[model samples]
Target: MSVLKGKKILLGISGGIAAYKTASLVRLFIKSGAEVKVVMTPASKDFITPLTLSTLSKNPVFSDFYQEEDENPIWNNHVDLALWADLFIIAPATANTLSKMANGNCDNLLLAVYLSAKCPVYFAPAMDLDMYKHPTTIANFHKLQLFGNQMIPAEKGELASGLSGEGRMAEPETILDFLEKDWQDKLPLKGKKILITAGPTYEAIDPVRFIGNHSSGKMGYAIANKAFEWGAQVILISGPTHLQVNYPEIEVHRVTTASEMLESCKDNFESVDIIIAAAAVADYKPKVVSEQKIKKSDLEIDIVLEKTTDILAYMGAHKKKQFLVGFALETENEFQNALQKIEKKNLDLIVLNSLNDTGSGFGTSTNKVTLITKSFEKEERPLQSKEAVAEDILNKIIQNYEV
Candidate 1:
């Protein structure tokens, strides 16, 4: 999932040929799961229709301070609009708009919102090559940066004037990448590598049957996505599950049996800064393998079983500088069992969830958990979405671990 998910973005469009690109930009933001509201300069409507942008953003385009259609005038509150956004972006920022913004000239609703916004502001300048290189434009750019506005520099490309030098608005994908990277730089886990195992391992009994748990991998996948959002390079080793994650920072490895998961973890553990074992791996597998499907007959058949290798224990025994976390699912004495696992596996932290909790446990989107440290420090959390739980877990790790 995108770090941009659920973020409220205020998009400001200024008049320029580049204004046409804002349609694709708004579409990109919406595709990334962000809520978009567009505020265009009056002149910008000449370049791109409000209907097109509104259709893409799913919000009415605001170009004026009041609605003329209503017999009773309804004022558009710029302050309210400014406060509602997590980020404010001005694309196709024309020379006129840039000058007004740098000088605090609130001539339009978009400019008024920029002046009132407390959120981070970004502007992508676009114009003819000569106009872009003008001393006044350069001064405005520097002044805006001084006022805490981020600038997405114009790319070098052919301009509408049939001249190629610079001053072309950045492409939609580039702008999104820029925003994502900027968000990442402010995260606590920036540049850190995280190794996570998720889902339930399947131990094959025969060609037609297998041993598996009810784990949907929702919790683990949530954690991986959260870590990636916090700028961690994540290696998600997953067992058989239906869940899928779409993030550039995560590399997923699929596996079946416990042995496969163990090998993948071991192979990648040395390169990671943190390890989280969230997979509900089977404790044992059938020792004898039947090449064909075991037919269901009147006679009862016995299959010998053997204990699987203890992955967490092995990781703890071979601990270096990496922070190790484990998960414990218990039906009774949850706290004591989790604490014991923390000690036994030499885990830096353990997350405990009870099957008895109504909103928690397997196949649910919500979870109630108790976070326990090796030092026996415990923090209990109420039921929340798995995504929120993942954030809480990462926050706790950030608090306890130095890196």
Candidate 2:
């Protein structure tokens, strides 16, 4: 998936022939799963109608600070618009707008929001060859960069003036690709490979029955998504579950039994830089399997059970240079038990979740976890969404892992 997925993008449109291209830009942002809000200079509306942008973006386009409603003008707060965005971009950045931006001018609503925005700002300059080559324009670009604004360098293409040079706005597709690469390159986890196991392994007893836990695979999926967002190449070994990975970049191996999960992990473990053992693999499985469904001839029947292969312990025994992490869900002696597992499994870290804590354990969306290090250090986190807990877990690893 594009790195822009789920991002809040504030697109700024300025007065230029390239202003019409903002429509395509907005469409591309929406197609990539980003939420877009457009802010257009008053003069920009002359080139592209607000109705067109509004229909494409599914959000009202803002040009003026207020709308005249017969003396009851509705106000649009620039600060709110600024704060709502995760990032802002100005396309078709005319010379007039660039100078005003560099000089702290707030002549229009777009400039006002730009002045108040705290998120990263990017601009794509569009003008004729002479204007682009002007010394003042070049100085403005340097000044904007000095102020921490990124410039999406203009492309060389046909202009409205029937002249072609390095002064055309980047095509919508190019703009999208540029943003994705820029965001991915700056992430801390870029170039790292991660392996994560999730869900509860099911041990089939008969044709229709199996033993499994209440694991929903929510926590592991969250971590995998976060890892991908941090630019890591992720491989997920998941037991049978209804959950789906959000990004297509994740290499997923689906397994139903503990033995299958173990084999899958073994196949990918040597290639990963880090391993997170999140799957609740069944400790025991039925020794004998019936090819057909067993009839209810006996009210109570004895079925022989045997221990499943311990995937984590195997990884520990074969460990070379990989950072291994484990999870322990305990009903008692949570801290002590987690620490012991850390040593036994040779894990670099362990996440401890207790059933005693409310809103945690099993299939719940929220988790209250204590992170235990190899040295027995404890960091407690309050109950929060699984996504937030996943963020914390990865943050701990990223802080200590070299990659």
Candidate 3:
């Protein structure tokens, strides 16, 4: 009983070392009963030839809009291609392809198809440690997250970069797990507009430096991704994170600072059926930033700090019938603080995490959470993958909303 039985998926492959993984990914999709189709970028051919993918998918690989002019006038029409899938999975989404998707740059058939895709869109990025860590790459990631794309967080492993760090593409099995999660018949939050804020927001101190936290956006992005799988119209207003967008029904907006996040939240809050504030926004920022890099001086530099606006409180005051959710990451008195926020922010439910818990908080792949509701009833759960934790949250929401 595979969830993907009869599902039609369009697998988009780009130029990257991890492109080789798609061959097996296609096989997994097919074995699970999905009708898999392949779309390759011109650069993708350099890593894994289209012929190989064609053989695996058992369908013609689409590269250019113009079909070969040998005995057939039929072209690879981007318009028709966009409508041919229940989902689109773009693996090994190189930095260039991500940036193009971010800015809606349609220069080729792949870009055109992506732009025109009315179905769910998924991207898996692969790159070296340095390129993945570059500021531009981080910024592009933020762009995709804000665009409401679903991102499969890269696994940490030895990379082609010769250095050990973050940048590896997710394993094919992991991607398959998330891709088919939405196959259930029940649409609990169907037609509801939910907005999720995720990742770590940056507070600029200088052009070269910013105050940030270790929010992987894992929890929030997982919530956003799962919500879309349930057929909700999700708008993910995210901070800076190395993630890509997903659901065609989900739109994303990116922000970097407390102010930027607040602004984006307010813009979308009115139309939302629910709002989840899972981002780790900076608590303070330099009151006055020096225009240029402050040269080393013998004098002690005192950076006056100011508190950032609390997004949850702001929305709480303006909230209507829409359900509101908040995340509390505490170091001490965790339950007390979470209870206060549930009342203070008028949240229907709040997810509680403590820095004290080993696997639950910070940048870990797993989390232990306590779900607190309006009556202060709590459900303490053991550690699980961020993806599973997200499902737990959504399940609670669905039960509450009776969707």
Candidate 4:
């Protein structure tokens, strides 16, 4: 997989019986299009020598900066090594190494690099059942998590010492898959959660008829997918759309009417970090929806209508700390109408769609949008695929957060 193409991985080998597996892991990473650098501890060399790993990785392995006695080895620079790694992974980590890492003890080249790494760091611990279950080991694991380090839990299987238990280093194949998945899952919005509303909400006129827009929910689904790829946990509440969410990162709640969509959104509002109100909900609903289909109607018929709940405005009043975004589709006074919604609903940003521009509105794969901020500044762009527009909108949200 080119997923790890041009990626640099630092494979740290600590003292463990599982150190013998490093050769296979190194080859796997290389096959997956990654540059592998092996860093072994002195004790680790007893189980598997650096020569075995160096041949597989096609790079010299280094354990320390000090020169050897009688036959001196060249000193390796820790700073250069630490800066070269895109991800530092310590597989077959021993309990002793875990304690040292947790305590910030940088006595070795590997430990020093671990302390200095600014990139993502991961570890796979391996030991006997007793050590893995120890209270101290559990505490150390938590300490690493607090520092934002990722841990690959060891598998339960036959150990080298003839004990079948929960401390075997995860298999080379499993670890390789984990590395690839972690490398590809972008986390720009990590630790942030969001809720979104999409599609056209129907207002029932009779058993067989309703009032709704031509909204395809394409733009909204694109936004949700992009947000999820950026690492946000998304809850999508949609109304009367045939769309199927293609990502596991999003939780979809399908509804039929404006009221149902609003209720679902309200239920998830507090837990969400941001809210995108993109659904085209009817402003008015027939006061009395006939139980039966209206058949053989008169030449001219009038249906009494009542105001539907304004989703965004209702949110503005009940909002605590959630960031809100809205959309305005208008045939005339587009910018003005969008700006008014931005101010009235307390939205951080509003996207304006003009009906006057052909191929730029509902039921189309393309959209030309004007992003109007709460500050009254406008940025307009030409029509593009809904996915590209979603990317632009996500980037704008990132910029807004930075500002």
Candidate 5:
């Protein structure tokens, strides 16, 4: 799969003959599985219509700061756009725009976004050879570079001026290649393998009834996606949940019962470098399961319960070089219970989620968590999206465990 998959790419188009090339560039980015957002200079709309780029990108192209068509016009916040992007690319950057960017001139919304962006910025300059070689253009290029902007050097090709020499924007395919190579080199978990268990395991009591928790598998799936983005080969052993793994790097094994989940984890445990037991495996299961559903006529019913397999403890005991992580969901004594689990399971780290916190716990998109280590270190994180929480957990693991 392409490294650009799931990336947020902000494509900035300026007034130039090569502005038309941005259509192909947006298509390439989308084809590579990236979310592309186009921001065009007002003059760029004259060369290529915003409708064309917007349709291809599947996002409304932004040029003006506000929507004047509405009774109460909404302001398009440039800072938010700047912070939202994974990378910003300015294709067909004209000398006028380049000069404005280098001099910190924020005349247009595009320029304002450029000035505020915290992510990496790349510019592809396009103009006639004479204009491209001008002293002012050269100075602006150097200034932008000194400010940490990467220049995708204009290619030598046939120009609109009927002169052919180093003034055309790089081809869309070439630009894509450059981005993929650069991102690949920066992936921290490129060669690592991660095994994650997620969702609630259902312990079957009968054909029609089972024991299960309210776990929606959001937390675990979020972790799996984040790990895949970091270039790890992820083995997501998930319980019965509606969640789906979209990344090619993630191999998912779906299971329903606690026994099935345990077997799945054991099968993949030895091959993985990191193991995260995030699944809410049932502790007890009915000892005697009826082949047929229990009749409702009984005045009272009795079902014997027995302990289920401890997957985390089993993996922890058998661990060699793998970093074992566990999760503790508690309603009381959260920290103590989590710490006890870490010691009993021999986990390298444990994530604690308490039901006391609003907007946390199962079936929610947000989470409030406390990360505890075997060494008694604790870090508390406020309520955040599950995806952000997943990234935090992975960051801790990478910092302390990854060699």
Candidate 6:
């Protein structure tokens, strides 16, 4: 998946023949999973219509400072548009617009938004060969870069003036590739591999009956999503969850039993830098799973049970350089139980969840957790959405991550 996934990108269009290309650019950004809004210079409308852009972007196109509604002027807030963007890109940045940007000339709404923007700004220059190589235009490029704006260097190609040289704007595909590479390079966990286990495993007692917990896999899927967003290559081992992840970057392995989950973890454990075992694996399974359904004939039918494979302990015993983490859902002595699991399971960190805490535990969207290290140091978090809890857990892991 593109690193631009979930990013809010504002595309600025200026008057140039290349303004026609912004339509393709917007489509490409949307395809890469980015939210796009377009702001066009008044003169740019001659090259591309606002209706065309609006239809493609599925957002109202903005050109004038204000539009008449009921014959009343409703201001288009430039600051809000600037602040809403995670990134701003000006493609077909004509000489006129580039000069205005370099010299603080806010004549149009696009220029006003650019000047007000707090996010990273990128400009793709488009002009005739001679105009692009002019001393003033080159100076503007240097000035913009000095102001921390990135330049998606204009490609060498045929220009509208019939001259073949470095003046044409980069192609839509090239711009997308450039953005993804630039963003990925700066991510903290760009090259790291993370293995996370989520949901509750099911142990079969009969063909039609099984034992399972109330785990909805929300917490684990949240972590997996966040990890991928932070640039980690994620492998998620889920145990019979109905939840699905939005990011395709996360590799999912589905399992039904604790034994199956363990084998899946074992397959990827050696190659990963970190492992978070959040699954509530059943401690016991029926020793003999009946092939046929057992009818309700007896008052109580007794089935022999045996201990399931301890996945966390197995990882603890076999870990080499991996930073292993475990979760402990406790009813009493929460802190002590969590600390004990840290040492007994050879975990570097453990997350403690209590059934007593309202809005926490399984089958809920919110969670309250105490992050405990092997040294017994604890950091307690108040009840919050599972997404926020996931961020906290990943942050703690990142703080202590080495190698």
All-Cα superposition RMSD per candidate? 4.6, 2.5, 21.0, 10.6, 3.0, 2.8
Backbone clashes counted, model 2: 0
Query: Residues 1-403, candidate 3, lDDT per residue (tens digit)?
Result: 4557667899988888899889899999999888988888888899898888888889999988876766775678887888999888789888889889988898777888899898878888888878888999889888887876778778889887677878899999989987766445446776788899999999887888888998988888888988876777888988999887555556888888989999999888888888888999888888887788878889997889999988889898898788888899999999999998998888899999888888889789999999988878889989899989999998887767633
Kindly report which residue stretches of model 2 are placed more than 4 angstroms away from their true locations once superposed.
70-73, 157-164, 287-304
lDDT of 6 by residue, 226-268 (tens): 8899889999999998899887768999999999999999999
Instruction: Please name the candidate that would achieve the greatest TM-score relative to the true structure.
Output: 2
Residues 178-265, candidate 5, lDDT per residue (tens digit)?
Answer: 8898888789888899999999998887999998899999999999998998989999999999999767658999999999998998
lDDT of 6 at 10: 95
Ranking by lDDT: 2, 1, 5, 6, 4, 3
Q: What is the TM-score of each candidate against the true structure?
A: 0.76, 0.90, 0.57, 0.59, 0.87, 0.88
- Compare candidates 4 and 6 on TM-score and give the better one: 6
Off-target runs (Cα >4 Å) in candidate 6 are 68-70, 103-105, 247-249, 287-292, 302-305, 373-384
Residue 55 miss distance in model 2 (angstroms): 0.8
Q: RMSD, model 3, all Cα superposed? A: 21.0
Return whichever of 2 and 4 wins on lDDT. Answer: 2
Residue 81, candidate 3: alpha-carbon lDDT: 83
User: Cα deviation in Å at residue 167, candidate 2?
Assistant: 2.5
Q: Please give the range of 10 consecutive residues that has the lowest summed lDDT in model 6.
A: 67-76
Residue 238 Cα positional deviation in candidate 5, in Å, after optimal superposition: 1.5
Report lDDT (CA) for all predictions.
0.93, 0.93, 0.85, 0.86, 0.92, 0.92
Candidate 5 lands at a TM-score of 0.87
lDDT (10s digit) by residue, model 1, range 1-403: 6678878999999999999999999999999899999999999999999999999999988999997888998898999999999999999899999999999899889999999999999999999899999999999999999999999999999999999988999998999999988886788898789999999998889998988899999999999988887779999999999899867658999999999999998899799999989899999999977899999999998989999999999999998989999999999999989988998999999999999999999999999999998899999999999999999899989888965
